[model samples]
Target chain A: MSDKTTGNTTGTDNFPQENNESVKREMFKPLSRRSFMKAGALGALMIGGTATALLPLRNFKNDTSLENFFQQHYERLTPERMERILKRIEREIKERHGVDANVQDPKPIADVQFAYALNISRCIGCRRCVHACVEENNQSRNPEIQYIRVLEMPAGTFDVEKSDHYYSHETVPAEGKYYMPVQCQQCENPSCVKACPVSATWKDKDGIVVIDYDWCIGCRYCEAACPYWARRFNFAEPNIPKEQINPDMAYLGNRIRKKGTMEKCTFCLGRTRKGLLPKCAEACPAGARQFGNLLDPESVIRHILREKRVYVLKEEMGTRPKFYYWFDT
Target chain B: MKNNYKSVQNEAVPEFIRNYGLFLFQAIRLSFRGSTAFYAWMIFLSLLSFFGLRAYCNQFVEGLITTGMTDQVSWGIYIANFTFLVGMAAAAVMLVIPAYLYKDEEMHTIVIFGELFAVAVMVMCILFVTVDLGRPGRFWHLIPGIGRFNIPVSMLSWDVVALLGYLAINAHVCGYLLYMKYLGKKPNKLLYMPFVFLSIAWAISIHTVTAFLYVGLAGRPFWNSAIVAPRFIGSAFTAGPALMIIAFQIIRMTTGYHIGDRPFRLLRQIMTISLLTTLFLLGCEVFKEFYSQSLHNSSARYLFFGLHGHYALVPWIWTAITFEIAAIIILLSGYSRKPGSFVWLNMACILATVGIWIEKGPGLIIPGFLPTPLGEIVEYIPTYNETMVCVGIWAIGALIFSWMLRLAIPILSGIFRKKNE
Candidate 1:
C-alpha cells in the first residue's frame, strides 16, 4: 500500500469513479497562475519519483558503507587493510548470526595449484554432502542457496542431458544410475573471472578462483559464464538460523554472503587453506571425493591423473577445470 | 528595480542556452491537462506504471525468488525485453540514413521524431538493466572512475558504452534541432550534422554489442553464432521502419500533421527489404542448426519442435514465424497499396511488430538456456512480478513517446504561431 502511490500523481485511473470525476473537475481548470502551479507541482512529483527509485538503497546503505566503497581490490589491499576487513567480518558474523566466527584472509602458498577428483564408481546417491555444504558455507536457508547439486544419470552413458536432479526413490543408489556431484571446477582459465565487468572475481596464484564479495556488483555475467552450473545468487537477504551459523570462516571462502551477491563452493578455504580437507570430501561416506595440490608429485589427484583415465567436463570449451571425474574399471 | 536585476542576469546567459530552457518550459506546459481522450490514455498508462513500480518494490523486498527464474534460466523477462528494446532504440537510424544520405525532402521533415524516439528507448534500456541487477544500489560499479568498468574485456561493459553514447549523441541532435524549430530559426548545420552522422554508426554499434552479450558466451551453444550480430541489425531495420510508418499515421489523426503518401511508400520499401533479409537470415540459422544436428543445436531444436515433451516455447516460435511470413505476403500484395487499405497496412505493421518482438525476446534469450549447462531443462514461466515490471517499463516507454509526440506535434503543425498571428 505504501509503495503503490509513487510520485504524488493522484492519477484519475487508479481512483474510484466519484473521485475521478472530482479530479477531472480539478484538472480542467483555467489558465494563468494555475499553469505555473502545475509546473511546480510536477517538479515536486519528479523529485518524489527519484526518491522512490532510490528507496531500495536505504536498506543496503549501512551494510555496504563508505569503507566498503573505498576498500582496495583483494590483490591490492595491504596487510593492515586486510586485517581490518577480516575483523569487520568477524563483527558482522557475531551481530547478524550470533556466532563468534573467526573470519581470516589466508594468502596462497607459492606454486601450489589446487585440484579435485571424484571417483564415480564408489559414490552413493546420498545427499548429506549437499546439506553439509550449505551449513558449512553459511548459505541462506529461507530460499535455500545450496552450492552442490548431485545428478543421477543412467549407468550406460554420461550424457548430462538425461540427468535427473529432483529425484525421490525408495532406496540409495538405484540400480541403473550413477550419482555425480557438480560444483565450481575452479577452471585455470575461469570464464567467470573474465566475465566480471568490475574485476570483482578472479583466480589467485594458487589457481583457487575467488570472489571479493564486497567489490562485486552482482551482474551475474559470471553466473552465466560458468559451464558447470556452479554459481548461486543471493536474491534476498540471507536468512540463516543463528544457532547453525558456521563459526570458522574465510573472507573469500565460506563467510556469510550478502543479499544480491553470488556465492559458490570455494573448496572450504577456511579449512583447506590450513591444510585440511574440503567438507564435501570429508563428509562423503563412499570416499569418492579427492582434494589435493595438482603440482604436488605425491598428491592423490596427481596419482589419479597418472594411473587412471581421468576427464574434465566440457573439454572443448577449454575452461581447464581443476575438478576431475574418473572410473575404476 | 527587480526587473533591472532580472534583465542583468538574463543578459549574461548565451542566447541558445536561454532559448533551450524557455522551450523546455513550453514543452512541459503543453503536456498538462490534455483532452478527455488524452487524459484517459495518460491516466491508464500512469496507473499501470505505478502498479509496476509497486511490483518492483515487492521484488526488492522478497528477492528475485518472487520471479519464476532459477539458475537454469538465469536471465528471464527483464533481459528478454531489454534485447527487444535495444532493437527499438537502434531503429531511429533508418530515419537518419535516407534523410541525410539521399537528401529526401519528405524524409528530412520526420527525422526529428525518430531521434526523439531514440532518446525515449535509451531511458527504457537503462531502466531494464537496473531492474535486472541483483544489487542495483551498486550501480556506481559501472562508473569508470568510481569503480571498475572492465572495458574491451566484458561485452556488457562494451554495451554500456555503446548505449549511453548513442543516447547522448541523439539527445543533443534532437534538442538542438527542436529548440531551433521552436524559435523559428534555421539550425547551425555544423553544431549538429557531425553528431547526426556519428549517431548512425553509434546506432548500429548498440545492437551489435548487445548481440555480443549473448554471442560471446561459449558455454551456451544456442547463442554462440556469428549470425547473432547481423540478425540483430536486420531485425532492427524491419521493426524500426515499420513502427515509424504506423506512428506517422497516428500523428496525422491526432495532430493534423500533413505527412503525404510519399513517406509511407518509401518506408514500406525499406520494411520489405529488411523484413526479407531478417526472414532469410532466420532460414539460414534454422537450416544450419537442423542439418548438422550438432549437440549445440538442442536449443534451436527445442524452439522449432518439442524437446523432451517440454513444448511450451513451440507455439511461441511458430506463431512468430507465421506472423512474419503473413506480414510479408500482405506487404508484397497490392492490397497494401490500394486507397483505404490502411486496415491491411495496420494489420501488417502490428503483425511485424509483435512477430519481431516474439522472435527477439523469448524466442532468442530463453531457449539459449533450455538444456542448461548441466543439461537440465527447467523451463521459465515469468511470474506475476516479472509481468508487472515488464508492463511498467513498457508503459514508461509509451508515456515517453506519447509525451514527446504531444510536445512535438503542436510545434510541428505551427498552432502556436497561428494563434499569435
Candidate 2:
C-alpha cells in the first residue's frame, strides 16, 4: 500500500541543482579558514531555518490533538502514518491503561470467506454466549456488551415469542421456547458502513464492518442506521472487571471501549487472527455455534451452505449476511 | 415650600430602603398568589432528578449495568433525545432568519423569544448528552484544539462547533438587544446583522450536519439513505414554527400582550409550507423503502407495521400521522385563514409539535436498531428514570426561556421606562 521513495522525488530533484550552484560559487571564492568558518556558520543557520519551517509541518504530521485530528479527517491518513499512530497508541495505552497491550498489525485474513452458522435446534438459550462475549471482548459490565441476543421463539410458530429481555436466574429454556442467537452477520454490503458520514465505520478486506474508535464521534448514527440493531454505543465507559478483561485485544476492532462511541462484534477478529475460535463458539455447550472459512469447500460452513436448508436473517434486503441458521428437520 | 418640606420629610427615612422594601414585598406577594405551575414543574423535575441521580449513581457505581441497553440496543432515549433536540435547535432559526435577515417587523417582536427558546433547547441538549456519557467531564475535549475533532469524517465535530457558535451568537445578539432596550436606547444595528447571517447559515448547518451524521453511517441499512437530511430539515422547520406559534398564543392569552394578527398569519403561512415539505419528504422515504425491498427494507417495515408482531412502535407512528394530517388540514382550511381562529390554529400547532416530537425523537431511531446485530430482536422499553431526566432537562430549558422573556418583554414593550428624567 505504500510507495515510500516516490514521495521524495520532488525534494530530490530540487536539491541537486541548488547544490551545483553552491559548489560553483564556492570554486570562485578564495579559500581561507576564517571564510570557511563564516560559510559553515551561514550553512548551519540556513539548515536551522529550514528545519524550523519544517518543524511546524512535522508537528502537523504528528499532532494527534482532537481538533487537528478531526480537521485532517480519517480517510486522509496514509498506512505508514497509521502505523506510527498505532505505535503512539500502544505507548499511550501503556501510560494510561497501565497494561502492556500487544499491538499487532494483523493483515486482513485473505480468501478466508469467514462465515458463521448456528443450529437453532441445539441452542438451549443458556446465555453462555453473552457471558463469553463479555469475557472475550473487554466490555463494561454496566450497560454490558451483549453481542449475541438469544430470543426464545416459540416452536411451530415463525412469530416472535413473548420473552423477557432481562431473563435471569437458573430457569432453563422452557418446553416451547426455541433459542435464536444473533450477532453481526459480517455483511457483503453493510449499511452501517454506508451511513457513516465520516467513514468512521467500514467493511474491512475480510467483510467485517469495523469502527475506528478514535475516529468515531459518539453520534450513534451507526447504531440507529443498522437494520439488525447490531451496533452498540458506549454511553459511558464500558466497565470490565480488571481480572476478567481479556488481555489480548484488537486495536480498532475490540479493546476497552471508551464512552460515547459505537461498538459491536467483529467475529472475534482478535482471536480468529491468532487461529483460535471465537469465545462464543468455544463456550457453546450444545455445539450450536459453528465458525469456519466458507471459501474452503471442505469447511463445515461451506458444507452447511451447500447441503443444509439454511436461511439468513433478513435475506431479502441484500445486506448479504454471512451468518446462517438451520432447523433439525 | 410646604409641599417640598412634606416630600423631604417623607424621604428622611431613606428612599433606597423604602423602595427596596416595597420591591421585596411585591416579590413575596407574587410568589404567594401567582400560579404554582413553575413550582409544580420544579417539584416534578426535582423528583425526576432524584431518580435520575440514583440511576446515574448506580451507573457510576456498577457501570452501564444499571440500564437495559445491551450490545444490540446500545443507543436508547439519550441518543434519540440528542438527535431530536438538535432538530429543535435548528427549528428555532426560523425566527432568526425572518426577523433579522428579512427584517420582518411582525417577526421582530417575537424573534428574541425564538433565540431564547434556542438557548434553552441547546442547554437541555447538552445536559442530556452529558448525563448520557460515561465520562461527562470529557466533554471539554470538544473545545476546538483541546481534544481532537475528527471533522470531515465526523459530523459530530461540526455539531459541537455549530452548537457552541450558535450559543455564543445567541447570547451576544440577544444580550446586546436586551441591554439596549433596558437602557431605553436604539440597538446597535451594525453588530447584529453579521451575526444574523452567521446564525442563518449556522441554523441550516446544524440540522443538515445532524442529518449527515446519520446518513454517513454505511453499515446501518436504514440510516444510509440520501433522504435523511431533507427529512430532518423539513421536520425541524415544521416542529419549530409550530412551537413558536403555540408560545406566542400562550403569551398573548396569559399576559394580554397581543403580538397582533399579521405576525400570526405570517407564522401560519411558514408552518403550512414547512408541514407540506415534511409530508413530501416522508412520502419519499416510504416509497424508497418499499420499492427497494432489500434486507435494509425490513427495519422500515418493522417501524411502520411491526415485524413478527413486536408492534411496540405501531401506536407512535399512527399518532404522528394523525396529528400531522389534522394539523395540515386546519392550517389549509378557510376557517384557519380567519382572523379570530388564532386559538384553533394554536391548538393545532401544539398537537403537531407534540406529534413530530414523538416521531422524530423516539419513533425513528430506536426501532431501526431492533433485531440485534446477531439477528435477535430484543424489545426496548425506556426505564422510568430515563423519562424523568428527559422531563427535568426540558423544565430547565423552560426556566431559561421564562427568565429571558421576563427580562426582554418588559423592556421591549416600553412598559419599564428608564429613569433618565
Candidate 3:
C-alpha cells in the first residue's frame, strides 16, 4: 500500500529525468554573464514590443481626452461643469462629424411624469416610427439601430412567440394582424438600472429612464436585464451621416453615443422635456401614438389610463412600466 | 506556539523583510530555469498569448463587432469562460477542507498546490472579464470610492466582492505557507488557520455569488431558477478536483516527488460523488423545464431540442451529457484501487473537467439569451478571434500555475531553504 501511494513516482520513467537534473544544476549555478545578457535582451524585447503594440492608441487621441476620461457621473456634476461638458461634446462632434451639434443637459420639469400611450388597434405596420426614431436619435446607419421594434402579432393571440418581427407584407397592416411597437417601457422599477454594476443609469424624477453614456462601462448587463429587450449596445462606432446628424441633442437623451455604451429610448427627453412631441408620435401616419405628462389629470395619457383598457407589456414581470398600450376607445 | 515565539524573538522585523525580498528574488530566478520541454511549453503559450493580444487589439479598434455577439445575444464566449473559471477557482476548497479540517496528512502535504491553482484561476477569471468588457480602460470605474459601485442590488457587485475576497484569502493562506517553508520555520496557526476556514466558506460564496449573478436576472427565465446555485456548487466540485488530480500527477512525475496515492484516491472519490450530484441537479432542472412546459421553458427546449428550426446547442449539450455520464461510469467501475487503473482514472478526470466546462459555459450562457425576451431567435456562434482570446486566457492561466509550481515544489520538497544565518 505504501509503495502504491507513490504511484506517480513509479511513472517517472515516462518523464526523462536527465533534463530535470540539468535544469536543477542550472538553477543553483551562480548567475552567469551569458544568462544575464539573455535575460536583459529578452526584457528589452518585451518592453519594445509592448511599446510598438501601443502605437495604435494614437488614433484614439482624437476621441479620448483627459477631461472626458476623468468626467464625473451625471448626477454629481454641477451645472457649470455640465455646461462645460456640453461645450466639450459639441466641439468633439464638430471635429469628428463636422456637425454643429447643440448638446444640452435638460433637467426633468417639476411635477411632470412623462407617460406614453400607444393605440395598438389603430397601429399600421408601416414601420415609419422605426425610421423616424433612428433619424431623430442620431443612431447608426450602416449597422442600423432602431429603438422601436414593431411586432406584427396575429389578432387572435397576445403571445409574442407567434409574432413576426421581420414580416415583409409590402403593404399596410395585413388582415387579421395588429401591430405593437415595443420600446423601453421606462419602468418605475427598472431591472436594467438595478443590474448596472456602475450606477450609470437611473429613473429620472419625470419618469424617463435615462443613461449617462459617459459613465457606462458598456458591460451590457443592463441589456440582459431588460425584459422589453429595449436596450441597444453600440457594438461598433455609431456612424450617422454628416447631414443626418441630429443637432438638437441633450446629454441624457439623443446625443451621439460612443462605441461600447448602452443606449435606449429615453422617451425622447430631448424633445419631450421641452413640451414637444416625440418624433415617433409626430411621425406615426395613423394617430396611434400619444405622449403626455401623466401627472396632469386631464392629459390624454391619463384619460387613456382611466377610461381605456390600457395594459403594460410583460406586466407579469412586475416592472411597472409607464408606457401603456391600449386599443381604440 | 513556542516555535512562533522563538522566531519572533530571534528574527528582527528588518531581517525578516530582507529575507522575504531575497526569497522572492530567488523564486523569480528559479521560475526562469526549467527543462527543454518546459521552455518549449512556455514559448508556445507566449506565442498564443501574443496572438491573443493582437486579436484583442483588433477588437479594441473595431469594437465588439469583431466577436459574434449582437444586440440580440450580447454575451459570448468570454463571459462563458469567466463563469467557468469562477467555478474552477472555487473548487480548490475541496482540497483545503480535507487538508486542514480532517487532518489528513497526505492532503496537508499537497494542498498548497490547490490554493496556488485557485490564484492562477482567479487571474484567468479577471482576464476573461476584462476582455469581455466594452470599455476595459474604464475598469477603474468599478473602484468603490472613485466610481459608482452599485452594491446589494447588483449581484455582479456581490460577485466582484466575493471573487476578489476569495483570491485574497487563498493567496494569503498558501503564500504564507510557502514563505514559511522557505524560511524553514513552522507556520503560525494564528496567521493562516483562521483564514483556512474562512477560505473554505469563501470558496463556496464565490461560486454561489457567481451563480446568483445569472439567477437573479428575472428577465432571463433560463437563469431564474432557485436550483442554479446548488448546481453551480455541484459542478464546480466535480471540475475542480478533476483538474487537481491530473495536475498532481504531472507534479509528481516532473518533480520526482512522492505525492502519494491517497490524494488521488480521495479526489477520485470526490469526483464520483460530485458528478452524481451535478447530474442529479441537472436532471431536476430538466424535469422541471420539460414536465411543466411553461413559456419560460423555451430556453431549455432550445438548449436540449430545437426551437424554430434552429438547434446549435442541441449537439453540444448532448455531447456534454454523454461525457459526464461516461466519466461517472468509469469512476464507479471500482478499479481505482489497482495501480494500473491510473490511466482510466486520468481519462475520467479529463472527461469530467471538459464536461463540466461545457455544461456551465456555452451550454448555460448561450441558451439564456436564446428565444430572447421578445421571443426572437438569433443564434450566436463565437468568432475565431474570440476563440483565440479564450485560448489565450487559458494559456496564461496554465503559465501562471506552472510558474507557481516552479517556485513551490522546490521549497515544499526542502531543496530550497534559508541558510542558518
Candidate 4:
C-alpha cells in the first residue's frame, strides 16, 4: 500500500516533500541528546500529572471500607474469620442503616437437600408471597426488588410468553387466570453459577444457589445467563427502612446487599437450614407452598416428587430445578 | 574493531535495553509534534475524553442508577459497544492474513497500522468492560491466583484470556516492529513471525470467544444459534476493513503517506464477500425464528417487530439493514471503482461501518434482553450520561490511534529514522 501512494504523491509535484518540510518548519526538530533529555522530563511530568489527578479516587477505600471490600469469599472463610466478618457486617449495617442487625452465617445441614413444591391448583394469585418474601429477605423497597414474580397466565395455555408479569386484578384469581410465582429454582445445574467469572456464586450442599455479595464484581453475566430470570442486580444502593430491616440475616442469604452486586432467592436458607419454613412458604395463605428435605424419603417434597405430576420451569434448558409446581391430582 | 565487537556482545542485554528505551523515548517525542489541525483534533478528543472521565466519576459515586440499565435489562450499551469494538479489534487480522499468508507486499507495509488500530480498539474494549462493571473496584477478584478465576467453564473467562492475549500479541508485534524500524535493524522472523501467526489465529478466537460468551447461554435464545460465531466473523471482517479503508484514506491525505490503492482494493473485495455472508446469516436466523415460531421466538419478534407495542428498536434495526443493503449494492455495482467515484467508496464504507455498529451494538444486544428471559418486554434506552460515556470512549480510541499514527507516519516514510543512521 505504501509504494504506490508514495509514487503518486511524488508525481503530484513534490507535495509530500512540501508537507514534510512545512511540518519540519513548525514542530519537527532534529533529535539531539539535549532534546531527548527534555522529552524524558516532559513524559515524566505528564505521567505524574495524571497520577495526581486520579489521587481523589483513593477516597473509595474509605467508602467501601478496605476490610469489607476485600473480605474473603464465603467458602474459604474459617469459622473464627467468619465470626469476625459477621461482626464487621453487623457494625457496618448498624452504622449505615442505624439499626441493630444480627448477621449470621448459617451452614447447610448435612444430608439435607432442601426442595420446594407449590400446589398450583390451590394458588389464588394473591401475590402475598411476593411481598412476604421482600419483608423477610430485606430486598430494596424503593426500586422494589422482588425475588418472586407471580406470573398470571390465562386458562388452558402453558405458554410463559403469554403470561402477565405485572398483572393487576381486583379480586382473587380474576376470572380464568392462574398464578405461577417464580423465584430462584435452586437448580442442581445452575447456569448462573457457571456463568459467574469470579466463582462468587455456587450451589450449596442443600441445592440452594447462593451468592457471596462481597465477592461479586457485579458484571451481571449471571443475570443474563439465567433462564429462569431468577437473578437480580442491585443497580442502586438497596433501601430498607430501619424498622423494616430484617435484623436476622444470614451471610449468604438475605444480608443487606451493597450496590452493584448480584442477589437472588437463596430458598430462604437463612430459615430453612434451621428447620424454619421459607418466608414465601410460610406466608402462602392458601396452604399451596410446601418445603421439606428432598433427601428424606418420607418428606412431603419427596412424596410430591414421587406421586404428583409436578412440572419444573424451563426444564428443556437442562437446569434441574428442585422447585416443583404440581396441580392437585 | 574485533575486540570492540566482542565487548559489545558481552554487554548485549544492557546495550539492547538502552537502545530500546531510546527508541521508545524518540517515539514518544514524535507523537507530540504534529500540525495545527492534528493538535486541534487531539485537543477535541481530549475534551471529549475528559468529559467521559467526569461522567464516569459521577457514575462511580452514584452507582449504575445513573445509567438506564435495571435488573430487567442488565447488560446495556457498555456491553453493546464492547461487543462491536471486539469485532473491530478482530478485524485487524484481515490485514494480517493478507500481509503474511498471501505475501501481499502492499498489505505488509501497512499491516503495522492495522495492528496499531487493533491495540487502540482493544484498549477501548477493556475500558468499556471496566466501566460496565458494577464494582469496578473489585476487578482484582478476577485475577488468576489472588481472586477466584473461573476458567474452562465460564465462557467469560475464555473471553478474558482471548481478549488479553490478543491485546498482548498485537501490542508486542507493533512494539517489536516499530522498535526495529527505530533501531534501523531487520526484525528477526524468529522474533515476530510466530507471534504474527499466533495473532492471526488469536484474532479469530477473540471474536469467537466473545460470541460464545453470549452463545453458550441457553437463557438468551436470540444468541443461542450455531451461526452466531460465523456471523460475528462475517460482520467483523466487513466493518474492520471498511474502517481501515476510511482511516487509510485520511492518513494518506493528511500526512502524504504512501498508502497505495491496492490494500483498498483488496479490502473492498473482502468486504463484498463478508457483507454478503453477514446478510445471508441474518436471513438464516430470521427464517428459523419466524418460520418455526416457537415461544422462544419472542425476542426475535421484539427485535424485528415490536412485542406488545414496544417498538423502540424497530426503527433502529431497519435503518441498519438499509445501510448494509445500500453499501453492499454500491460495492457490488462497481461504482466505487469508477474514476471520481471515490465518494461512493467512502459512503459505502461509512454505511457498512455504522450499519454493523447498529446491527451488532444496540440491534443485537438490546433485543437479546428484550422480552427478557422470563418474557418481560422491557425496553432499554441509553441515557445521555450513558451515551456521553460511549462517545468519550470512542474519542479516547481516536486519540490513541492518532498518536500512534503520528509517530508511525514519520518512521514509515523514513523521515524519523535512527539518529546515527
Candidate 5:
C-alpha cells in the first residue's frame, strides 16, 4: 500500500533510490505512540457514544439526576419533596405531551379506607370501562394498555378456565353469560406489593395499591405477582396524543406513565381522592359499579357486604381483596 | 508440579501484588496462543457476538415491541435462558463437592475448569437479565442505598444477591489459585479453601433462589410448588456435570489437559441418577396435573398436551423429553465400561446438556405464563432479533470460558517450566 502511494506521488515506481527509501520508511514505520493513544481515545469515545445512544435518554436524565438519587419512597417522602416531585412531573408531562396536567400527590384520608363492589347481574360487558380507564390513566396507546379486563363467564359457574376476557361478542353480555369486570383487587395483602424487589409498589392507607413509577426498576415482578392479571407494563413510551392527555393526574394514580414502569388500577385516584367515583365506575352504563369507604357503616359497599353473598376471587389464596362481587338478584 | 521460579526481593509477597502489569500482559498474551481451530472458534464467537450486539442495539431503539412477547407472555426466551444458565452456573458445585469435600486429587486439578465455566455462565446469566429488563439503565434502582431493592419481600432480590455472591466466590477462588500457579507457589490453603466450601453451598442456593423467584409468585400456579426448588437442583446437577464431562474431553483432546476416566465415570453416574430423577419428577407433575383435574393444572396441561389449540411449545417439550430418555439409556449401556466408548459418553453429555436447556428454559417458564392469569393463552414465539441477542450472550460466554481455559491449562501442565527443569 505504501509503495503504491509513493509511486502515485513520485509518478514512477523505483525511479529513484531515495523514493524507495521513503517508501520503505513509510511502510515499515511503527505507529507513533501519540498517534496510537489518539486512535484509542477516539475508539473509546465512539463506543461510549454508541452505547449511550441505545438507552432512553429521558429515562437516563430522570434516573441519574441528583434528586432521583435522593428520592424517597412514596410513604416516606416529606411534603416539600412530594410537592417538588409533583411539580417536576407536571413539567415533564407538559414537555413530553404538550399538556398542562395536574400532577399531585393525593394523601389517603384519615379513617377512610376504600372498597369496591361490582354487581355481576347488571353488567352488559360493553368494554366502555376498559377504554375509559386507559384514557383517563394516560396509558400507552401503542401497547393498548387497559387496567380493567371484563371476563365473560358462563352464568351457572364461576370457573375462570371457562371465562374469556377477549371474547368479541356482538351483543350486550351475550346470552347465558355474565360479565365480570376484574381490576386491581387491592387486596389487604397484595401479592404485588410483596413481590416488588424495590419497594416501588405498596398498598396505601386508602386500601389502594400504588406504584412509584420513577422508583420502579421495571423488573415486572409486580406484573408477574398479580393474581388477577390486572397489572400493565409500559413496553414503550406512553404515546398519548396532546388532545387526549388527561390534565388531571396523581403521582400514584392516573398520571402519564413512562416507558418500562408497571401501571395498574389505582381506583382512579385523581377522582377517588376527591370523593368522586373511578372513571370506570362512572363510565359504566348499567350502573353495575359500587364504590364507598369500607369502614363507613352507612356506605353502600358495607350494605352490600351485609346483605349479599359476596365472593372474592382466589379466596383460597388468602389475598383478602377489598373488591367484592355479588349477584344483584 | 514443583515451584522453581526466580525469587523476588520479598519472596513472601506475590509477584502480581508487586508488579500487576507483567502478570496481566502475560496472561492476556497466553489467551491468544492456541491452535488454528481454537483461533477459528474464537473468531467465530467474536463475529457472532458482534451481530448479537447489533441486534440488541436495534431492540433498544425499537423497544420490546421488536419481540413477540405480549402482556400474556411478558417473559420469553431471554428469561428462560437466564434460568437455565443459573442452573449451569450452579453445576460447578458438583466439581466442588468431589474435589474439596471428598479430597479427590484428579478432581481437584480439573475443578478449575468447572469453576471457569461457572464464571462464564454466571456472566451470561447477568447479561440475560440485563437484556430482559425493560429499563436496564435504571438498574441503579437495585443498588444498595443508591436505589431501593426490596430485599426480603421479593424472591428476585434474593436471586440477585445469590448470583453475585456466587460469582464473587468463584472469581476469587479461580483468580487466587491461577495467580499462585503463575508464580510457581503453593496457594494458601486458607485463601481459597474456605471459598471452595462456601461456593459449594452457594451454588445450590443460586438455583434454589432462582426457583423461588418463580414459585413464590402466587399468580402462576405452575411455578408455585415445593417441587420447584428440588426440580431445579435435579435438572442443574444433570446439566452441570454433563457439561464438565464434555469440557474434560475437549480439554484432553485439544490441550492434552487429560483428566482420567474416574471423573467421567462418576459424572456419568450423577447424570444418570439426576436425569432419571428429573424425568420422574416431570412424570409426577404430569399425573398431579392430569389426574387431580384442578384449575391450576391448566398450565401443565398446556405444556404437555396443548391447551385450547395453542401448542407452540409442544414440539420443544417432547424433543427435550426424548433427549433426556436417550441420555439415560446411553449412560446406562455396556459402553459405560469400554474405553473406546468416549464418543458415546460425549454424546450422552451433549444430549443431557441440550435436553436440560430445553427442559429448564422455554418448557418450564412459558407454560407458567400460559393460560395466563386471566385465563388467556397467547402463544409466545421469539423474534429473530431476540434470538440474536440470546445467541450473542451465549457466544460471549463460550469465548470467556475458552479464554479462561487457555490461561489456566498451560500453568497447570507446567508449560512455563523452571529453568533447571
Candidate 6:
C-alpha cells in the first residue's frame, strides 16, 4: 500500500526534470542569497497551496483505497494486519493528538481466556460500573452516553425497581433489591451488525463489538437495534473536563468520540488490548464483576462458567453474550 | 324637497359604507398575501428559536450533561420526535401511491399536497435528529463512497439512504407536478406508474426500516421482541393518516376551501384500520411481556405502573391508552361517517395522533433503558431546553407546511376547477 504512492512511475519524470531544472536554473541565475531566498519562499508558497489543494484529493483516494483493503468488516481482519493497524494507530495518535494514549496489543492467551462474570448476589446497585465505564471508555460527561447501567431490581421481583436512579447517598443497596449492571455482552452473533445496512460496527477479534466512531452517522439505529440497550448516542459534544479525560484511548474502541454517533462498551478494548483488565473490572470493589479472555480455558472466566453454572442475561434471545452471571452457591 | 333630501342621504350613506368595508377587507387580504404576515411569523419563531438556539449552544458547549437524560434513560423527546416525524414522512406516501399508482381520481387533486407535507415533515425529522446528535454537523458523513458504509452492520447507513431516497423521490415528483401546473400543462402520464410503485414501496421501506432499527437491538429485551416492527408500522399508519385528516380539516377551516366529504370518509376508514392494528400490536407486546414474566417484564411493568416510587411514566402511558380508546370509539360511531361529523372525527384523529406519538416515541425507548442490564434504575427527564428545541423544530415543520400549502393549494384548486370547466 505504501509502495503504490511512493514507487509510482508517474511522479518520477516530473520530479527528475523539476529538480535538475531548478538546480541548473539556480546556477545560471547567481542571485544574492536574500533575492534567492525570496524567490524560494515564493516558489514554496505556490507549491504549498497546490499541495494543500491536491493533498485532500490524494488523501481521499488513499483513505478510500486503504479502507477498501482493510474493509473486511471488524471480525475479518487477520492477526498480523490487526497488529500492524494497532501500531499504525498508536503512531498516529502520538503524532496527531500529542497525547500519550496507550494502544493495547495483547497476545491472545493460549489457555487462559477472558469472559465477564457478574455476581448478582453481592451487587449493591450503586452504579459504580456505569461511572467506571465512562472513565474507561473516555465517554462524554453527557449523562446520556453511559455504556453500562446498573438497575436496582427489587426483592422477589426482577423488575426495574427504581429506588432512585439518582442514588447519591452514602448508604446504597437501599433496603429491597440487588443491583444488576448491564453492558455490551459482546455477543457471538450480534444482531446489531446484521441490522446495519452499512457495516459501520462489528465485533473485533478480541470479542469486543467496536464502532468506528468516524463512520457512525448518529442515526440511533444501532441504539434501537441493540437488544441489551447497550448502545448510546452522543447527543451533544462529550464534555469530559480536560483534567478528567482518560488519556489512554483506543483508535477504534475508546478514543474520544465526537458528537452524533453511536457508542457502547468494547470491554475497555483500549485497556484489554494492552493486557490490562477493563476499568469496570478494576472498579468493582465488591468483586461483583470479573473479566478475562473467554478463549482461555484456564482463565477465571472459564472457571466461573464451568463450576458456577453461569447464565446469560437474556439467553432465550440466543445472542450468545460473552457476559455471564451466576448466583452465589 | 323633503323626498329628494331623504333619497340623497340614504344613497350617500349606503355607498360610503359599502366602499369603506371593501377597502378594509382588501387591506387585510393584502397583509396576509404578501411577505408581511409571513415575515412576522418568521420573526416570532426566530425569537423563540433564538432562545432555544442559545440553550442548544450551551448544551453543545457544556455537553449532554446539561440535559435531564441520565445514564439509564439515554433517549428523550428528541428521539421521539425523530420517530414521529419520520412516520409522518412515510405517511405522505399515502397520497402519492393512490394518486399516481392506482390513479384514484379523488386523490389526484391532493396528491401533491401530501408530497408537500412529506417534504415539510422530513425536514422537521431531520432537524430533530440533528439536534439530538452530539455533533450535528457530521451528518454529511453518511454519504456513500465518500464516508464509510458499514454495510450489513449499521442501521444508520440504511436510514440515511432510505430517508435521502424518499426525500428525492418526493421532491422530483412534486417539483415536476408543480412545474407542469405552473406552465398550464397536463402532468406527464409516463411518470405516474413508476412514481406510484416507488411511492408504495418507499412508504413501506421507510417505516419498516425505522422498525428494524429497534428490532435489531438484541440487548434490550423490551425492544428486542419480534412485535416491534409490526407495532411501528401499525402506529405509524394510524398516527400518520390521522394527522393527514387533521391537516385537511385545518386547511378547510382556514381557507373555506373543501377537499370533499368522500376523501374525508375514506381517510376515516384508513385511520380506523390503522388504529385497530396499532391497538392490537400494543396488546400483543403487552401480552408477551406480562405472560412470559421474564427479566424483560420489569421494564414493561415500570412503564405501565410506578416501578418502586418513580411514577413519572405511568400517568403518561395511561393518558395515551385513554385517548387512544376514545379515538377508536369516536371513529367507530355511525355519526362519524357523516360529512358534518368530519370535524369531530378529525378532532378524534388528532388526539389519536398525539396518543401514538407519546406511546411510540418517548414512552417506548426510555423505559426500556430504565432497569439497565445491571439492575440500576435512572430516571430520564427532558430539560426545558430539550422541550424548547422540540417545539422549535415543530414550528419549522408547521412553517414549511404552511408555505408549501400556500403554493400548492391555489394551484390545486385551479387545476380541479379547470378540469371541471
Report the lDDT of model 3 for residue B142. 88
> Model 6 - which docking category?
incorrect
Alpha carbon lDDT at A274, candidate 3: 92
Off by over 4 Å in 4: A1-62, B1-13
Error of 3 at A271 (Å): 0.6
Per-residue lDDT over A1-329 for candidate 6, one digit per residue giving the tens place of the 0 to 100 score = 11122211111121234443443343223346875575576457545544542332332111122542334433446887767766666665455446666665443334433468998887777777788787777787744467776766667764443333455557887776567777888888787766544466776666677786655545455554566777777765556666665676666767776655678888876677668888888888888888887777778888888888678876777788889988784
**B294-372: candidate 2 lDDT, tens digit per residue:** 6567667877888766887888888998899889998888767866666678767887787787778777777656654
Q: What lDDT score is found at residue B165 in candidate 3?
A: 92
lDDT for each residue of candidate 6 in B309-333, tens digit (9 for 90 to 100): 6777898999999899899998898
lDDT, candidate 1, equals: 0.81
* Whole-model Cα lDDT of every candidate shown, in order: 0.81, 0.67, 0.86, 0.86, 0.80, 0.67
Best prediction by TM-score: 3
Could you tally the backbone clashes for each prediction? Answer: 0, 45, 0, 2, 1, 50
Q: How does each model score on TM-score?
A: 0.90, 0.64, 0.94, 0.93, 0.89, 0.72
The alpha-carbon deviation from the true structure for residue B55 of candidate 2, after best TM-score superposition, in angstroms, is 5.7
Return the top candidate by lDDT: 3
Candidate 3 residue lDDT tens string, A46-87: 666556545545555335789989988888899889889999
Name every residue pair that clashes in candidate 3: none
On DockQ, the stronger of 3 and 5 is 3
Interface RMSD of each: 13.0, 27.6, 5.6, 5.3, 16.3, 25.3
What is residue A274's positional error in candidate 2, in angstroms? 7.4
